[model samples]
Target chain A: MNFVEKKILEEGRVEGEDILKVDSFLNHQIDVEFLNEIGKRFKELFKDQKVDKILTVEASGIAIACICAQYFNVPVVFAKKMDSKNLDKETYESEVYSFTKAKHYTIKISKRYLGRGENVLFIDDFLANGRAALGIKNIVDQAGANLVGIGIVIEKGFQEGRAILDDLGINLHSLAIIEKMEKGKISFKSL
Target chain B: MNFVEKKILEEGRVEGEDILKVDSFLNHQIDVEFLNEIGKRFKELFKDQKVDKILTVEASGIAIACICAQYFNVPVVFAKKMDSKNLDKETYESEVYSFTKAKHYTIKISKRYLGRGENVLFIDDFLANGRAALGIKNIVDQAGANLVGIGIVIEKGFQEGRAILDDLGINLHSLAIIEKMEKGKISFKSL
Candidate 1:
């Protein structure tokens, strides 16, 4: 978390008061070494839980979830944001509202991948309004699977995402939590 | 490669005449162990090449490229399928015609990540029409980067993807090449 926070301070660009773009290393261009560290951290946090599958919503979440899945020794099931012809017809779908994109999109996962009574850990690159996380959790619930915990690379703590998931009683862990972004500067929550 | 071939024969589903869905373990739901094998295989195939970065398209390709980047000990840069507000305005863009979706979409990669003279290896889940592959190649060319080779998880040999890339003089490698898919029976090319 220190390294992630340091990276954010050094490399993350704060556009306006609400957006933190980490495309240089985290999202668009991925640093496999850093991702491996993130994987190890997630594993350390949720070492007690039995994670059968790591769930995420594409397209940014796929890389983080897949890298973290390697540490868990579990497969990753990413919910597709757009309905693709390649996806199966029988799927567990959940509608999510994206504050960033300012639209509602359906996230879907094949019913065959997530079975009943399976333990799933949700992972994502950024947790803002917690819409994507909630949507993935909804899909996990619909599949009759247990939501073990949520792992986030960066959480916008100034936003209500953490509180929302906390109110739902979902165990959530974020590597770097940004407390505030003021005057193009990011402030992290002191652990 | 044998493990990948066996995985395809077991979990891959054939839909219609040309669609082979391997979402069970390849795209939608990713098997990290299998992906590790894929990474090793890709490394073995391109062991002699000097790969500086692993390039791939967003959504499905991100997972495989990230996994494969580990073996190459390089970073992964995935092209965005859509123009998100978060994406930088300065990008290397290419138009790709999706044969499955029957539409042309613009894929963008940030100009900062890909540098001039960087050695890149393109990786993807499937290679059919080779439009996406060519599109990425175009972006790499635009950046004045060197494309060492292209790595695909599955190649539809019946299609013209390989031929197009071959015509372009690109060294292409596919883990499992499906020679024919008839009545849901899949046949792979002999190694």
Candidate 2:
């Protein structure tokens, strides 16, 4: 987590009051080395939990989830944002609202992939409003699967995302939690 | 490559004559162990090349490219399919036509991520008509970067993807090459 926090302070871009972009190493352009550290940290944090599978959303979360899945030695199931023709017709779907995109979209996973009574670990790149994470948890609950824990690379600590998940009594772990970002300066929560 | 081929023969579902669904191991529901094999195979195929970075499209390609990047000990830069407010304004953009989605979408990568003279290895889940690969190739070329090679998990040999990349003189390697799929029977090219 120290490595991630250091990288965020060094490379992360702060835009306005609410947006922080770590595209250089976190999301758009990924650092595999750093991701390995993140994987290690996630494994350390959830070492005691029984995780059968790692679940995440498309695009950004795929890389982090896949890298972390190696540590758990489990399969990864990425919830699709768009219903492609390639996806199976029988799927577990949940509607999620994107605060940045300012719209609602559906994330889906094939019903055949997630079975009943499986322990699922949800991973994502950023946790702002916690809408996407909640959506994934909803789908897992619908399938009667147990929500083991949630792993995040970066979390906007000032936001209500952590509070929402905490109220649900779900264990959440973020590598780097941003305490504040003001006028292009980023601050991290003391872990 | 044998493992991927075997997985295809066993878990891959053939819907109609064109669709070969291997979501169980390849895309939607990802097998981390199988992906490690894929990562090793990609490294073996491009072992002689010096790859500074791995370039891939968003969503499905991100998973494969990230796992493969670990073997190459390089970073991954995945092109975003949608324009987000958070993405950098300066980017290398290309339009890609998706056969599965039946729509054309633009993919963009931040200009800061890719640099001149950087050796890039392009990776993707499927190579159908080679449109997405070519689109990514265009972005690499635009950045004045060198494309070391292209690695694909599954290549529809019956399609024009391989031939097109071959004509361009791009070094292409596919783990499983399907010669044809008819009557729910899949045949692979002799190794």
Model number with the top DockQ: 1
List each candidate's DockQ score. Answer: 0.93, 0.90
Would you give me the overall lDDT of model 2? 0.91
Q: After the best TM-score superposition of candidate 2, give how far the Cα of residue B178 lies from its true spot, in angstroms.
A: 0.5
TM-score of structure candidate 1: 0.98
TM-score of chain B of 1: 0.98
TM-score, per-candidate, Cα-based: 0.98, 0.97
Candidate 1: lDDT over CA atoms? Answer: 0.92
Candidate 1 interface RMSD after superposing interface residues: 0.6
Docking class of 1: high
As a whole number from 0 to 100, the lDDT of residue B107 in candidate 1 is 96
Clashing pairs in 1: none
Give model 1's DockQ, 2 decimals: 0.93
Model 2: per-residue lDDT, tens digit, A132-176?
Answer: 999988999989999999999889999899999999999999888
lDDT of residue B26 for candidate 1: 86
Question: Candidate 1's residue-wise lDDT over A30-63, tens digit each?
Answer: 9999999999999999999999999998899999
C-alpha local distance difference test of each model: 0.92, 0.91
